[model samples]
Target: MNITLKPTPEIILTGDRATGPLHLGHYVGSLKQRVFLQSQHEQTILVADMQGLTDNAHNPAKVSSNILNVVADYLAVGINTEQTTICLQSQLPALAELTMYYSNLVSIARLERNPTVKAEIQSKGFERAIPAGFLTYPISQAADITAFNATLIPVGDDQLPMLEQTNEIVRKINHLANKKVLNECRPLLSNAPRLPSTDGKNKMSKTMGNTINLGASEKEISAAVKAMYTDPNHLRVQDPGQVEGNIVFTYLDAFHSDKDYVEQLKSQYRRGGLGDGTTKKILEECLQSLLGPIRNKRAEYLNDKAQLMAILKQGSQAAKEKTEKTLFDVKAVFGLNIL
Candidate 1:
């Protein structure tokens, strides 16, 4: 009989843009998964300042300011600092070097066809008038993933193309060098990956002024709840309501833990007796309960800026060492290590 040993756990790389404070959309989308991933794998969270600046170059200060906020949000959401390393993308020189090399392997046409990049360009109204960096960010993202040799990346449906792009680079590079230096990453898609805007217009974010932040105040939560979009046709309590397109109910479905209670509410609303006011009230309460502890934890992290900065610095150093090893291996394979 042959003896078998368990393979090492895979590395997980996931993070957020420091464009603004994270909101519930991020929580439902990736943060919660990251919190769980910490213990299960070699998880490293990147505060993607460089990535965030691909579009925010005009206002670099905004990108700089939100770095700590994103870190605080991560810690607040239960991302264990001990198990998961949190690093700043800008501090990782190896990642930038990797991006430059990876760019050579990819054609301009391939970059343009990236669905996530294309959608982002359209959403930002850039069309063809986009920055080169914005267009080549998929390569940057690939560098971010490969530097850590990450095998599992938590992403939404839109980011699947980016992951595909990363693995494309991995295959090309490894095949060319005949060495598996870069690891291919796959997406961990959440069942409910995106939360629509509070008013159901589109994304929930700072630009839209529609998101409820993880550290939102009670008053702010109240405001978001009141502003939440419900089926316009369901004005009267006795009117038959629609649950399919209601953003308030959508939020409840994501945040509320009690399945039976939520089903009861949905039944009442669909059966023509539940008022929008009542449902909104329930959602507000659910959000408040969910966000309250996160608010406290975020506050604790923010209050001690020195400690937060220290944690990030330590993690950044660890990340630098890992990326350095990868860069050294990659350079040796290609005879690019002239230094």
Candidate 2:
């Protein structure tokens, strides 16, 4: 996979909601890429607690408690706190100020038209009583990127529309404010953004009970991998199976060390003699090899919770200092500075 080279180190904005422990789907889909990008770009990973609260507003404790869990996930996955700034979104006041300004730039109808938000609303069954905060989160995300003056946003394909909306706000704000304060952001769309659940559902979600947490115990991971859904039609060990839709093969494609082995397995399965047990065992071994280090790192953080919190606090402070400067400039542009 070729990473596009920027003329200078481009600023990047990427993050996850702190609703639960980061899962395998999260690692393969985005975090793994993020770990690599930190060395090449100016990256900031936001623990999006503020956004998580949009839907879970009634559960403040859930959002607060998981902030560190999400940070731990970041650290365990090799997102170096020294190289990448990881911050809590709610701690940055500039984001709210920028979100407010961007809100005015975007119409309510435009927010309604965002495909990502629309799909989420329908999936969550919040059709009629959509929370206002939830409805405007794309704007908040716009605030997130522009506050950092980020030039690239790593997001899933489903979030392409949200990036479009953010760019629209950037363009509008730049024109209206009569300054090119906000940079137009390009979407770094992941090749496999939406990893399906082991059950072969369209998405792997914590709420859907289809996720393998990054911090899951060896036993837990073994159980989950054992029960993973494979090609249902391949009922017998001798029956020829289709590897195209097999979730186990998908995991292999995403995480395996030897592509040759995966290809051999696929060919054998397609040719009619590969047992599902054999294929699954291969996948389990490949995945365990990949996740073992991450699990160990997570355990270390879990054992030393105080040190983890200190890292988060340090990162959050650094992030706020940068964001505060941007907010001051934005306020000056709008003539809203009171002091």
Tens digit of lDDT per residue, candidate 2, span 1-339? 999766688899999888889898898889989988999889999999999999999988878888888888898999997789988898898899888877777888998988889998999999979999999999999889888888998887888898898888777767768988778999988876467788886477667778888988777777878888888899888889999878898888888878998899899999999998998888888778778898999888978989988887888899898888878877777788987
Task: Go through the candidates in order and give each one's C-alpha lDDT.
Answer: 0.90, 0.86
Query: Which ranges in model 1 have alpha carbons more than 4 Å from their true place?
Result: 1-8
| TM-score of candidate 2 against the unseen true structure | 0.95
TM-score of each: 0.96, 0.95
lDDT of 1 by residue, 1-339 (tens): 998875577898988888899999889888888887788689999999999999989999889999999999999999988999999999999999999989999999999888778888899999888999999999999999999999988887888999999999999989988977778888888877478888898767687779999999999999989988899888789988999989988888999999889999999999999998899899999999999999999999999999999999999999999998888877777888898
- Alpha-carbon shift of residue 77 in model 2 (angstroms): 1.3
Which candidate tops lDDT?
1
Considering every candidate listed, which one attains the maximal TM-score? 1
At residue 85, give the lDDT of candidate 2. Answer: 93
Task: List the pairs of residues colliding in candidate 2.
Answer: none
Lowest lDDT block of 10, candidate 2: 201-210
